[model samples]
Structure formats: structure tokens, C-alpha cells
Target: MERSEPARHRGQTAVAVVLRVLAAAALSVDAVVHARLAPGYQAAAPGGLGEGNLFVAEAVAAALVGLYVLIRGSRPAWVLALLVAGGGLAVLLLYRYIDLPAFGPFPAMYEPVWFFDKTLTAFAQAAVVILAAAALILHRRTRRA
Candidate 1:
């Protein structure tokens, strides 16, 4: 008789992949909206860079990562995914903890609500990145056994 180890539980990995895809989609949509519907809002943000450009870059990168997840097996794909998620977390932290106050006093060109809204958005994005990183790590370790 031949025996095989039980299949691994992959709920977290599935979740991580789904989140990555959703995040990518959301960023792509935001990019389109900013370019077509909210140019003023994009220009007024703290980065001074065009929000449309930024979001487009984000979306493209994320879509590439999603492609990797779909085409590759879990090990290599997870490594790449973790790197992407970790980079996102780092960017979010840098914006929230360093860039926000450094560029303080909210530019006269932008409305107060815009500043607050961007801040909240950065924090929320950071949370998602953090969650993705942790989930990837947990999923990796779980699958190794």
C-alpha cells in the first residue's frame, strides 16, 4: 500500500491571493477615476506627483504580481507576493510616519478634507499591506510542513 500525506490547508494563501487581486483592481480603478474624473483631487494631494500616474504604476505592478500568483506554483509565487506585500507596507509606513508630517500644514492649493482623506487612505492601505504580508508568511510556514 502507498500512503500520502494529507493535503495542506490553503485558506490563508487563497485569501492572500484574492486580496492581492482585489487591491490591484481597486488601484487600477482609482487610477482611471483620478485621470478621468478627479484630476484636481489628484493634483492637490501631498505627493505633488499625479495620482493617476502613481495609481497606474501601482496597478501595473500589482497586476504583474497577480499574474505570477496565477501562473506559478505557491513557493516561488508566494516569495514574490511576500516581497510585493512587504514593499507596500514599507511605502505605507514611510508615507504615514515620515512623509505626512514632513509635508505638513496642508498646501493652500488643497482643501482640508483632501489632506485628511489622503491620510486616512494611506493608513488603510498600510493596514491591508500589513495583513497581506502576515498572511503570506503564515501560509508559507504552514505549507512547509
Candidate 2:
């Protein structure tokens, strides 16, 4: 049992590293996409204060979260990482599949289209969500152990 401890530790470290890298890469992709789309979205907006600004904010948030997780591997970092990913994923999935009506102030967000931007964002966001969630679970398990 003692002889295999080092190997187990190394394996766990490798898995954690892989998860971090995966989550970071996905966040980067999504962030760039949002940044690229922001100007166009804002330009086409009714008052230039709708989805476009939201995109910019999301881009910044994603970058910060990604950088934080990529640089530091901690349970708190993982929790934040998953929260951002999960929130973005929820919005994307909802606007993709659901025909949501307009909220109190927000316009109806029923974008049932799958262009290159949408496709890339969905893929990257999904990856980030999955990897972040996995990393969080692994972290919790390690803490308990």
C-alpha cells in the first residue's frame, strides 16, 4: 500500500491539472466569443444597453474566473469557477431551447438560432461547466478524505 501511494498522488495531481486546463480553455473560448460579439450586438441593440453590455460583462467575468482558477487550485476557486460556468450554461441552454417571454424589463430572449458564434459558445460553455463541476466534486472528495 505504501509503495503505491506516490503513484496515486501523482495520478490525482495529473487529473486535477487536466481538469483545470480544460476548464480554463473553455472559459477562454467563451470569453473571446462574447467579446467579439459584443460590438455587433450593441450596435444592433435598441438603446445600446441590452444584451450587448451583458455580453461584455460576461466576457470580463469569464476571463477573470478562468485566470483565477488557472493560476490557483483551491476549493473556493473551484466553487467560483463552477458558479460562473453553470450560470452561463443555464442562460445559453435556456435561450437555445426555451421560448421564454419578456421579463419585467428585459426583452424576450428567444434565440433559437445556431450560428457559428452560438455553436462555439455553447460548446465552450458546456465544456467549462462539466470540467468545473468535476473539479469541484474532486476537490470536495479530497477534502473529506
Candidate 3:
């Protein structure tokens, strides 16, 4: 049996709302972790575009994007969420595995260890990536539908 268009649309809307909330929550977690760790990292690498400043920037971006997704939940918002989370995740993994030297104004943020905050932030970023991707997929399908 086929579902009515309104019924299907309602289901999609519910799913989208859930995805948006989860994505925003994950972003909030990411923001909190970064903000909390920013001070120590700043002191550890005090300079231009230092590690602490980078952390503060990340936290601000995450919070803003999360707010956007929560309020708008548009395709662009989802895309931004994915990009922010994906970029953070990539950097996290890269710095975790390889000890790359400091480049330009960026400091050498290489720490080959899995601490609690780091692990938690990674998980939050990963969650945002997955949730935002799913939301974007739903947005595309809904547009087509």
C-alpha cells in the first residue's frame, strides 16, 4: 500500500526535525569541548593563530552553525554543518596520527594521544557529519519528491 503525500511529508518533516536537533546537539558538544580546552592549548602554543585561538574559532563556528541548523534546517545549513564537522574531524585525525610541523601562522598541534576531551570531541564531530549528511540527503530527496 502507498502512503498519502501529506502523510509522507509529515514523516519526512519529523525525520528532518530529529536530524536537525541531533546535529545541533552534536555541534554544541563540539563547541563546548573546544572552548573548554582553548585556554590550555593557547598557553601551550602562544603565538599568532595559536592553538588556543584556533580552538576558540572552532568553538564559535560550531556554535553558530549549530544555531543555524537548529533554526533554519535548510539545505545550505546542513551543508555548512557537514563541512564544519568534516573539516574538524579530518584535522583531528590528521593531527592525531601524523606529527606535521607548524605551517605559516598555525602551530604544530600534533598530539599522538587519545585523551577524554579529544575523544569526546571526535565523537561529536563524527555525529554531526553523519547527521548533517543524512539531513542533506533527505532534503535532496524531498526536493525531488
Highest TM-score: give the candidate number: 3
lDDT of 1: 0.49
By TM-score, is 1 or 3 better? 3
Q: Tell me the number of clashing residue pairs for each predicted model.
A: 0, 0, 0
Q: Report lDDT (CA) for all predictions.
A: 0.49, 0.82, 0.94
| Top candidate by lDDT | 3
> What digit string (tens of lDDT, one per residue) describes model 2 on residues 40-75?
777656684567787888899889999888899677
TM-score per candidate: 0.45, 0.88, 0.98
Sequence-dependent TM-score of model 2: 0.88
lDDT per residue for candidate 3 within 1-145, as digits (tens), equals: 9999999999999999999999999999999999999998899766567899999999999999999999999999999999999999999999999999998888899999999999999999999999988898899899999
Assess candidate 2 and give its lDDT: 0.82
